[model samples]
Target: AQRVTQPEKLLSVFKGAPVELKCNYSYSGSPELFWYVQYSRQRLQLLLRHISRESIKGFTADLNKGETSFHLKKPFAQEEDSAMYYCAPPFYGGATNKLIFGTGTLLAVQP
Candidate 1:
């Protein structure tokens, strides 16, 4: 079973606070990991890729094969960064290239 699960439906926090977005996946074979973020009234964009090992908007994610998890974390939250975060696994071998996303985590930043 290839599935992506995001336990939290929503995550709200004050500005400047640390945020951790949990993600778990189940797959038989090796899968590619990605973090997609959509700001308020904005289109979805790629936040980071596990293979690249890079951080975007002060957010970073590490793929844990042992635990089958890819959690997104940020040291501090920003009001402007408030958006919907989705963890996705892209289809390999260029097979229509669909991204299997979790339900999604709505991050609210309070002033």
Candidate 2:
């Protein structure tokens, strides 16, 4: 079974401060990790993927295979950056492009 874990349910940070959201996973096979974000009243969108090595909205996440982790980080936080973040891994069954998400972390950036 593949599992993604986001230990923090809520995180608050002041504007301009750096932020890091912790994530861990347990999977026997090679994992495909992704970060998904949902803004207020908006649909969830892909933030980044381990395979892409791309950064979005000043946020970046690196998949650490050794640690079984993919922690998201940003050097500076903005009020606009506040959102619900989820760590997701592909479903084990290999059915379509579906993803199983971890309990998300709600990020609140105080102005």
Candidate 3:
């Protein structure tokens, strides 16, 4: 079965501390992986995709094909970075495309 797993439901850390949110997936074929974040009272936005290899808000994620993992990381987390992060993958059904999200991890950055 194809599935995305976020092992952490909540992560709390002080400002400037390093943060890591683990994500793992199981799929037979190549699948597009992404991270989506939603801040307080804000809409969800795409944070990064495995193919992009770009950092957003000082956060980066590297896809490890050998481990089937895509863990999000930030060297120095900020209070403003507190948000709910989700691991997503594109799901194709018939002729339509949809996103399958794992259980989100809520990051709480304390001052």
- Best of the two (2, 3) by TM-score: 3
Q: TM-scores, in order shown?
A: 0.93, 0.94, 0.95
Across 19-92, the per-residue lDDT of candidate 1 in tens digits comes to 99999999877778999999888999999989999888899999899999999999999998789999999876
- 74-93 per-residue lDDT for model 3 (tens digits): 99999999999999988888
- lDDT of predicted model 1: 0.91
Model 2 lDDT tens row, 1-111 = 667899999999999999999999998777888999999999999899988888888899988889999999999999999999999987655657679899999999999
List candidate 2 stretches off by more than 4 Å.
Answer: 92-95
Off by over 4 Å in 3: none
Question: Could you say which candidate leads in lDDT?
Answer: 3
Give RMSD (Å) of candidate 1 vs. truth: 1.3
Query: Quick one: ranking by TM-score, best first?
Result: 3, 2, 1
So what's the TM-score on candidate 3?
0.95
